[model samples]
Target: MTVPSPSAQPNSLRRRLMLLAVGCTMLAMPGAFAQEVAAPATVLPANGDEIQQFCTNIADAARDQRYLLQKKDLEKLQAEVDARIAKLEERRAEYEDWLKRRNDFLKQAELGLVDIYKTMKADAAAGQLELVNPAIAAAIVMKLPPRQSSLILSEMSSDKAAVLTNIISSASDSTTSKEPS
Candidate 1:
């Protein structure tokens, strides 16, 4: 058997038949042949009066939708803020409770310390207090009896004695007036 040469006329005929078959196949498929047409664009108003009239027609509905969205956004923000405030309040309560317990412990310790300082000899007490925090030393000195305090002050350095004396006087002053007491 001999193979025939591809002729130009036969090639053109074949191509045309193939195109016709493809066209028929496309028509047979509902989607290919009947694709939805693009939506017709609405005509925009030309003049200012016509544009204003269009805007006026839809104003109330547009405003209501915008307002609704804003309201929802505000409500969400309010809820978040409220949650944060609640968390802060809980933390504040925890802090206050911890502070109260710490203060209570310190108060008991301070009383014990004051008692110990009261029992020590004035010279020894002055020596020990001088090594301690000035405010604490002053507070201890203030708690001691007048005679004991005087003895302690006499034993301490002049500068230390003066500071302690000033602290003691200031602590004792109960006047609520703005003037120096």
Candidate 2:
């Protein structure tokens, strides 16, 4: 006839876990079961108290100076914002110029490649272009006069030729669309 331990009861683990969870939640909740305590009142200057009144006036002036300093800080912050925006715009313009120069260089290089490819045998040019970037291959084909492009495409595998044709056509369409009416 001995008393059974709590863990010996049915579903004891679940009950213990639930009790622990509830206890943790209660402890985690701020001011749970806490009593409210009143804060001590601040002493102020009494009527006709000269020294206390002077100190209060000085404090008020200091507070006003702090507010003025904050306004000055805001002005400085605005100037900094304007400076950063100017710098960002300058950087963006530089980036655009760099991109344009890079595009011009690539165009010249592509034209040179087209001349080289045109002099090669059609089958040889097609084989070399097959291993290069599809976009570059497509560009070279476009740069070649139509007769040479057709000969190169005919020499390529049908699937590769079809893909390059599609790329070239789409590129022309995009350029045409961007041009002013």
Candidate 3:
């Protein structure tokens, strides 16, 4: 093979060196440009009105949200209050019914007591000596008025009067014994 010329070899080496340098410079330029473009030194604001409008819009949205929450809370509170009122009304009605029943029972008891008193008074007047225990005699005496006690005593038999007097005396003695001193 023929040998290449020295001048041509030198020119080819120079061209390769120039191409490598140009490629490295092209890559380095893009990196530098990217860094400069990423971080700009200046900031722009179009108008104060735009920022004010944005803030007002945000505030209005927040106020509407709060109002909705408050309304829901009020509704819940009203429902709870209504339920409590209904419960209280039901309880009141039940209490009134209970009171009425209690009154009826008391009236019946009073009527029974009156009937028993009348029977005992009639028995005492008939001189039912066999039926008159101390307890029955005492109940008969208690039912009689203070002014009527003597009449009832006169109507009763001697044995019944004696038994009642003994019971009363024993009760008095027991009460006196229970004194502190």
Candidate 4:
């Protein structure tokens, strides 16, 4: 075989050196390979409030390059948030109105019960136990605290009060028996 010329030898040496340099750079900087492998750079929108805005801009630009999301999807998400806020405000107003009406009704009913209790007591002392006993028992059931009402019923005539006491005892027993395990 013929020996290679000196000029050819130098050219070969330079080519080998260039290849070695590229290999060493690839080993030293792995990110260089990704840069070489990816597509061209893209421009992004300028307006941004923070680093997240800048990152979002870059992500949007990347997505546009990749043909991902359209503008309509972004608008739809914004509309959904707005609708949820409006619904929450409407529910808050409804709850406030319900609370006001409930308080007013409870106040009126309590006053009416107090007037009935006064009338029943007046009739009971006038020897109208027959008429007053049932009214007084009903008033005690409706107006007095549960424990106090039970005690008062226990002290009344056994024949009449026994019925109210049985009702109360049965209610209490059912409540206790229905407790969750």
Candidate 4: the clashing residue pairs are none
Over 1-181, each residue of candidate 1 has an lDDT whose tens digit, in order, gives: 9656445355554545445544544444446657654332244333454446545644665676678889999999999999999977876676666556545534543776889988999889889888877767877776667888899999999999988777666545443223322
Candidate 4 residue-wise lDDT, 62-91, digit = tens:
555445455677778999999998977776
Q: Report residue 137 deviation for candidate 1 (angstroms).
A: 0.9
Q: What C-alpha lDDT do the candidate models reach, one value each?
A: 0.67, 0.69, 0.54, 0.50
Measured by lDDT, the strongest candidate is 2
Best of the two (3, 4) by TM-score? 3
lDDT of 2 by residue, 1-181 (tens): 9988754773554444444544444444445447443332244333345345445535654566678889999999999999999977876676666556546534854757978987998899999888888778888888888888888999999999989888777655523332243
Worst 10-residue lDDT window for candidate 3 reads: 36-45
Candidate 3: clashing pairs of residues = none
lDDT of 4: 0.50
Instruction: Tell me how candidate 3 scores on lDDT.
Output: 0.54
Residue 19 displacement (Å), model 3: 47
Worst 10 residues of 1 by lDDT: 172-181
In model 2, what lDDT does residue 138 have?
86
- Show the colliding residue pairs in model 1: none
